[model samples]
Target: MSTIAPARVVLEAAGIRKQFPGVVALDDVSLRLRSGEIQALVGENGAGKSTLIKILTGVYQPDAGSVTIDGAPVRFGSARDALKAGISVVHQEHNLIPQFTVAENILLERIPTRLPQLVDYAAIYREARPWMKTVGLDMPATRSVSALSAAQMQLVEIAKALSLQARILLLDEPTAAITPHETGYLFRVLRELRAQGVAVVFVSHKLEEVFELADRVTVLRDGRNTALDHEIKGLTQDQMVTYMIGRSDVLAQLPARPARGEPVLEVRDLATEAGARGITFSLHRGEILGLYGLVGAGRTELAKAIIGELKVTGGDVLVRGRSARIRDLRDALARHRIGYVSENRKEEGLILLHSVLTNMSITIWRRLRLFGQWIRRSSETAAVMPLVKQLDVRAHSLAQQVGTLSGGNQQKVSLGKWLAADVEILIIDEPTIGIDIKTKNALHELIWNLAANGKAIMVISSDMPEIVRLADRILIMRNHRLVGDISNSHDYEEVSAAIMSRLS
Candidate 1:
């Protein structure tokens, strides 16, 4: 562990209170961040963690409160103003323009110039190289931003913030999509930044990383401060979860059971145009069959191909022992009672600019027709609202845009959409990615309940614990082929070792 000494407060939010249409996002909350410290903010979905970050980063103005830096109160009208005040945020979504070069994106605001305000390309690259080196981003400055990987884009975001001379940095779910190897590199950079007296405010759902990297933690629950500011020393993950969810009891766990009856779905010799080759699997009714693999191991591609998103070159999909040919996503959903939930929810799984009700009712409109042609709004709401409530989605109303909701809540909506459509065979990929522990448990329970009600669930995930806890049977894929298949007896180490052996 790195040695550190307590320092003065660099930032503070006092008596914060923010209210939305029908919810109190923050209620008299307070938080303090010290210089040269990593302050982790943790909470369940819709606990007002995002609201607080928005208020601090100038995305939204607080209804009541004061934000101070170095004992001086300041008001920022916009994100640019906040950046000028030495506050910069690295959001989950990349903010850089994809068409721009790495150097151009890093120094976008203050590009170098020669006589007559001419854009100096050489000077821009030279200025961007130092910040990139400082953040340990080892990519060519002339490369396009779109060509970089997720981890590379994250590092570029940090470089851009450093180029702005940011004293206080705010990061939201920085490791959600990246691999563990990339996460190690990110932590190494954070440690170097911490030693340089920078104040980092990290907001993430991963509690293990929070405990490992943060010096102090602030826990929020139901729009109020449970632990406003507490040191991480002597704190356990279980204790932290208790503060966030107001419960110390163990989460409800499902017992293993054998799935009976005929298989709901059977894929034989599946071949997808998206690099999947010779994939074969069978999912029985009321079974939670899990596909476990590393990232880019053809798990998602196989799911998409089965759902008709990608073209299938050679394979057969049998639904309830009958061969089925799908035309597209709509045909797959309507003709066959098959639904697919994407792992990348923001881009593929959701329409972020629309209302939550609208996104959920996307597939329901065709189902709730008055004369088999027209959709009745009343009937649609009556059918979807129950599933929303059953899923425990925290929102002011159905009219709220899903983009404003937390990541976990948005995931709930994505799952609920399929449930609303009454799909018997459901395929959910990465259901608990970037979700808090409490929410993760709730989702697992929901999945278990769905399966108990006779819905065949096929889960594709890279999370080993999720697979071990939720699946009855596990299949491992390595280099686009099924390498191993085994029963999960609630033993994590055994399944993990078996999967690794197959991969090796």
Candidate 2:
């Protein structure tokens, strides 16, 4: 009898150790990738998943350990070196130049040249076409990337990485912004690449995706490897969560609570310039209202309209039964005590270049002024410290740059600023996007506590289980219109069915 031979190892990192000022980012971590296999690198936030990816892609150097390609030891001095060594990565954040055309960005690393060092525009578009089609991006290659939505931008990033045609591809939360249909297409493409003997490293917070796509799994926790290169077959999601978080009960469902008392926010026949039309809803004090929709369903735009970021073309907004003339975000926060936690947290929620303290205290800087004059740094620190502890944010100190923290910690700071301002009505968009299961549970519990404390919360999420778990009522939107408002029964099947029915 003849048997098929095993695939060869494409890349391996063994005994990796990395450290920062006050944190050991990675310690004795190891990862192995085989050709013709999709390997999942998973862990909770701060578990060294991002740190490992950076080290593998040459964004950071490891203090210890070695990397090997095809049984040959190699060292990558920079990202370019890694790419030259047949490695490419699509990070969690968008790396495309917004003003550039899609074709230009996709072929950025290897723009074709003509005679006399001249740029070749025709060659750029022609070379980018196949990659765009491979990722199922239907837009024209000449379109400006800035005009694309977040989901479309994510697709462009994937296309750009695929254009490299690297032997090893690393993807970090690649499906975080795209719709289910787009995710299905990407999965098909990844499978094709695996069949072509390309090694893939997929990093995501979604467990189902991992099980569906990966051939092997590597689990990390506290910068250490808990499981390395375990076959995906016969592995359960519960086991995976335990490996990541050291506990399987982190996703316990929140208790259902019905809304009561007077409406805190009332939107009547609201129409916005962003395409939301005739939307009407009432949010009561201590109520958790969910906004559910697919990508480009106008969920985020509706939240922006409520907070005055988008122009209201028609209808009225009432707070506490009184007409609210919210002119802008400042008016929404200061005059009306309405706050929004944007879905695009990296760009819209927190200032990455600023310190954690600065980002967390920005919302209340005006309120913290002494005698309506200058604000004291000591006072700012005092105000944000409690929230840092409350949110269990993992950072060296308040002075650390917000950009340096993990995705989950950044999200905490994003929501922490609004909590510091003590906003009565809060709009949180995609609260758990790209975050780990443990941090997600913590945030969900925090949201529940906030609502219990008489704060009305509007949660916009594509996560069906999250919506079913937290929201007292759900408003379904499709094609920029609200189609259904159903009381959440906290049953996943029932809630998901109701939501899909409305979406259809």
Candidate 3:
């Protein structure tokens, strides 16, 4: 009576519904992924993208839904269950053990056993090299994953999925941490996987990549599909952004530059042992200085040197027209009233298991105490509530664990963590690395506001558009050296060429 589809149906979900205390994350969402199609899942922050993916991957069981793989209905109670059903998820953050070899990480649970039930290390090395080569990753199976960079680790995660016989692969923000060359490599792998009849659900906020790689793009807003089957062809980036946010007015709310005042920070011949050399810069009150470069271009190194995280080999730092000795981070904080928002949010910034209030209050603990021995919860709450409200941190309450928040919210916590400490000179590194478009604009507004209040801001980012939009003056760092400065020009090509010249 009915003809079945010839293509393999890798996964299907029906009426998925997920709820939290105050957030209905997913509401009756339905999706079907075919064997070889690259389906893109896109939305603004807190738009149920992560929740739906978690449901599919069995990280969280849907309160009301049914998942079917190869036409067989299944209830996946745990991640192990989902993996056993031929599904694998590679998170934005790598989940591999750093100390383990690539071969061990690839064959994490199902390592081939010898007759004595011991791990066959030699066999593992022999088996893993070809798989790594298949993905165009050139690394020995015996090498530790810790020694690899961020992009290399991502390749390892994909390789691990390939080892698991992943019929359906979930890539959550795969290109966020990679370089342009590595991004191309990843795109090639995605194409190869699609050709081999492996379904992929790619989640990312970078619309360019989404349209470039996906066949069909699904847009979700407030747990409902705006456009589930929108073809990528003939789709404008602005139109896609509008569909995700449900409004055309977001672009009009950009900040207007008023003025930039006198110099608040000055550095001369600043050099760090870790490749930062002969750097000289100045930041004025009510000014936002942008440092743009590739991943290892000494942008962050210069920030650390200025903030006293890295020792200055031979240089002088002046704050508000006075010679300052920033021997250590705390000393710099105490003497110069400086604050730094680290690039690595999870590892360097926030305590995941701690509540938002606790993370915000960690810096101002003594300020809220009556006798420096007892904490005043009310005072701490009062002090943190305004910042929480101002930053638009979404949660049931400030008591919610920050780890449970989205990437954008986590970044807000990182920024708020420093703002709560009352730092005048703020150094923000990669403020919107993995954030969505909506969140990125919100953060840009916040940074503009901070600069408008006469708080000197130093922004270091790899995103060229962000740097061009925010920087009053742009400094190009290459090979740990400040090559050129763009003070009066906002020309993208000129600035980009200046930074890229050093790589050549």
Candidate 4:
């Protein structure tokens, strides 16, 4: 029975190498995927995880090494070629078309073709249902992709992979926005897939989930394979951290700061257009306030209302002891000096097609002119370049489109844009969502420094540990209303209880 349970190698990469203009993106990185096994890939920001995944999925061709599937060498020239070779990647970003129905998005290209090669719409919907069920998704197949939440869209991504009959799945940060319930469902599906002899490579920053789901763990650092193992049962989280960072001393130690000063923001009975109930909160100078809740709990809605992006049906907002009625984002920014980092950075924050310098300087363009009549490109680069450097935004050049950078680098640009704007009150929604650990630590440090400088910060996160680390006070919202507050304690169980109770 033990011998039968052992799996054989389904896919193997031998000495994979890739390079960018100024960087050795991947250097002799080797990975093994066994049939019916889930392999966890753990790494920091520049650890070559993305590079390797791209090579495997044929997004970027490798300079050296070869990929073998079931003991046969294969060269994949494109993502479609990789898919044809039984490799499917569910990226952190959902690639589904928002205007299309779930059924249409699922069977996007492979819709049953008639003899004349016309699309069979009814056949497409029929084929999508069982795939959705394979992942515990039950939304109407006819529903538009635009109507689904982040978690639901994630399920659709998995279903898309399944529709292609993927034997080797590469899931990159699939659970970042997923709730625990949804995560449980996804894990169950992966286990079933493993039982069916499908190999899976799971990439995530969540150490706890890695321990729970991975059959083996591989750590990458500085574009090299640092550690590989078939078992992580004996390794502590601290050990994993050390392997990923290449140093035991890189763990973050929160600075001990004095209590906050005067209140900078006050909300009384604020309600959003999304029907969040009367919500009240206060943010003090040099303080970090965290808002936590289950999916659909209205924490994001509250953030939207506070930022004045959504209409407030009731209540009032006060900025530094003065009654302020924020009817629009312009009013909010001009009067309150508020900065909002949205959860979906691609959609709500950065203009992906624009240059990094342009994205970073757009908010401060009015202040960068010589006589308020002419634009200064040199001055703009001088002001934005340092910020890009400080934030460690990786790109070939400042002229590169923001969309060309990796997910983590794009997020840094988003944050840099807000920092350049010099916002007084910062509302960060899921600040580290989909980012690797190294980048996460950098962002956490940046937020702490911002708070220390007397900027009021409201951190909205689904990650319980993140809220526990940085927030001076934690506010739990459930069903569009404030549930409870926890302070001066780092008990995740307490926060979990509050979140569960409010959600229930």
Candidate 5:
């Protein structure tokens, strides 16, 4: 008699289907993750990747279908319940409390206490040391989370997950905020975890990293599995790209940078109270100037100071060769014709529950008011539609909630608002973040088109290839100071080497 082999799958979602009023978020989607393997979950925004992950991690209950662990069906009523089932997640967003110590945050549920119910501070630190060491995260357990950088906070999240003694791990955009050096260390940790037979589900928009780390891949599109559990060997990135986007015609080539015109904006001795110091750069019309740096290098702080989000301790921001005093964001946008798209798009960029029409038109509302204190909805719709269409935002209608759209589409919506305002100088921070290859190409084309039209554009990105691909000139920032500048000739290798040299 022949015996059947037992299933090695550690975590799986079988035939998942989810619905939210008008949207079918997931339709018969299936994913299987085995022990000792890293399975990549990839798709365009709104392709149902997040929804499926939430189901596996117990954040959302699937309308239909079941989740299984080790061939045993399980129902998770809460995130805590999933944790108890040996599944843990490291979210893209930091979930730790700012006021709490790293150890307290990591061991919140299982803190050791004395007879008087007083927290055992010494034990708390010791409990977290092993997990932290596993990931090469060096930090005092007593340090406040607010004191840590974005990359350090991410490492804490990973350590916290490991503290749960999880066999199945889900990491969402884990490297989104980390530096390349830190990412290399993180990859080593993950490889070690895999060798120890831990199953991992990795989700990210950075295709290069996915290709480098994933042993197998799964592609989702429109809530269904288009490419389920595909092995990495013999599969080209081009083939995988086609699977997620569902078309080969999507533009991949970025246009050449337009000829540099006279300076549209100049920052002289720019210093912000938040730590950006002595930043000096002149952005010319028809030029896409990129700012590249590691996380917490004062890049975002510099942008904030220029746009008046952060109080400028000292500096002269000149517009068209003339000093323009930006009192606030409104002054920057309305008076100086400058606009900024923040890095934290979900929180600072859009009011998620609002409609797409509202999100795109919000910035231009001062102009949208027909009569005193009266705004015409039709006029608002008409004003933003052309730009929305230009960005190719996929939505059910103009009235559809912005939060319900895919990541790529939502980013377009965020960009659309600035376009609607018709700003002279636009600063976009990590525009293609969480965006697929096709959508990224479309965004690149739109960016170049704007610069080519004589609108000065400044792109701030942590991505080397992205900056190298798009920038005519790249500026490097380190420790709140301008360190180096390199003109791009589209030679990614040489440009990246030059960047690392300065950073090192």
Candidate 6:
């Protein structure tokens, strides 16, 4: 009987080491990607997954290592050089220009031109059609990318990569924002790419996706390789967790608590300008109320409406049984002692250009003021330092820019600012999105503890496992309205089924 031949290695990195100031990002890490295969690169945030990707994509040069493509040694001085070498990346953040058409974004690198350096619109659309079809993107080439959904935008990124004739494609946290149906579509596309002899590197915090998609896995821990290209068929999820965190238990079980005191915040028939209609909910003291939904299901909109970010056209908001009129986010925090930790930390949650001290203390700057106007630096430092230490923020110093920290640390800073504000009610949106498993567990524990200490927290998340684990009760929303409210028993299968049923 004849057997199929093993796939050949298309790309290899050996003895890769990278270091940043005050931290060794990677130490002697290596990865190999075979043609017609999907290789999963996973690790805790700050464990050097991003660093290695940057090295391979020529965004950052490795301190000591060698990269070879098809048995030929190569050094890329820039991202353009890597692209020329048939390597392309679709980052977690969408890289498409908002105002540009699909055709323009897909063929941006080498747009066809007419005389006098004019863009050839007809040629651009014609050239982009095949790549768009390859990725199952059926949108018109003339459509502006800003109008597309998150899933659609991702397909455009993939189409753009294909337009470059990339032999190897790297996707970073590709499904962190999409729904289950959308994720299945993405997996289908990746499988098709693998069949076409393309090498793919998939990076994600979600292990289930890694198991479902990747053929082999390379696990990283503490900036080093724990498992290098192990076949996925032979490994269990527990084993993968062990490889990642040196422990079998990925997340510690939070203790169940009896329902506490009367409602701390009550929303009655809340109608928002952002499409949330007739939303009514009561969050009691020390309760972790989960708001679960698919993308654009108004979970975030509900939170924004509650925090006064969205205009409440018709609603009665009661805080501690008293009617409250919160004018804006400042009013929500100062007058009502309610704080919001936004999911888009890079944009709304944090001032990335500023120091950690500045971002952490910004929420309480008014409270820290003395003499009716002047703020004391000593008082601010004293107040913010405890939160910094409590959150275990991994920064060299308070002066370090928030932009320089890892995804996990930046999130901690985002949460820390609210803790500094000493808010009684907190709305946390997508608390663990784009973070690693270990950091995710840490954040989950922190939220649980806050609720245990009599703080009302409304968590908005698309991750079912997270909502099930951390929430005492879940409120399901669909099509800008609440569909079901269920108490949690903490059984994944049971809770997930009920959650999905609500969506259906």
* TM-score leader: 6
Q: In candidate 3, what are the lDDT values of residues 1-504, reduced to their tens digit? A: 001234566788888899999879999888878877888999987889989988888889989989999888998899989998989999988999999999888888678878677878888888888779867778778999999988888888888888888889999999998877778888988888888788889999888789889877888899988887576878887888889997765645345577889888999988788977777889998899998887888888888888777878888899999988787667767778898888899888889999999998887786778886998889899989999999999878989999999888988888887788888899999999888888898999999899988889999998877887788888887779887777625566776665567556
**Greater-TM-score candidate between 2 and 5:** 2
Each candidate structure's count of clashing pairs? 0, 0, 0, 0, 0, 0
**Model 6 Cα RMSD, Å?**
2.3
TM-score-better candidate, 1 vs 3:
3
* lDDT to native, each model: 0.88, 0.89, 0.84, 0.85, 0.87, 0.91
* lDDT of predicted model 5: 0.87
Query: Which lDDT tens digits does candidate 4 get at residues 1-504?
Result: 011156898899989889899999888889988888888998987799988999999899999999999999999889899999989999888889999999988888587876677888888889999998888788889999999987889888888888998999999988887887788878888888888788889999898899888888888898888886446667778888888986664535577777799999999988778988778889999999999877778888888787777888989889999988776666777677988888999998899999999999888888887787777999899889889988888898999999888778888898888788888998999998877777787888888888998889999988888888788898988878897777736566775665567557
Point out the higher-scoring one by lDDT: 3 or 6: 6
The residue-by-residue lDDT of candidate 1 on 77-175, one tens digit each, is 898888988999999889999999999999998989996779999999999999999999888899999999898999999999999999999999999
Query: Among all windows of ten consecutive residues in candidate 3, which has the lowest summed lDDT?
Result: 1-10
> Higher lDDT: candidate 2 or 6?
6
TM-score attained by model 6: 0.95
Q: What are the RMSDs of all candidates, in order?
A: 2.8, 3.1, 3.6, 2.9, 4.2, 2.3
lDDT of 2: 0.89
Provide the lDDT at 84 for model 3: 85
Residue 201 shift from truth in candidate 2, angstroms: 0.7
TM-score to true structure, per model: 0.90, 0.90, 0.90, 0.90, 0.87, 0.95
lDDT of 2 by residue, 367-399 (tens): 789889889999999999999999998899999
TM-score of 2: 0.90
Inter-residue clash pairs, candidate 2: none
Comparing candidate 1 with candidate 6, which one achieves the higher TM-score?
Answer: 6
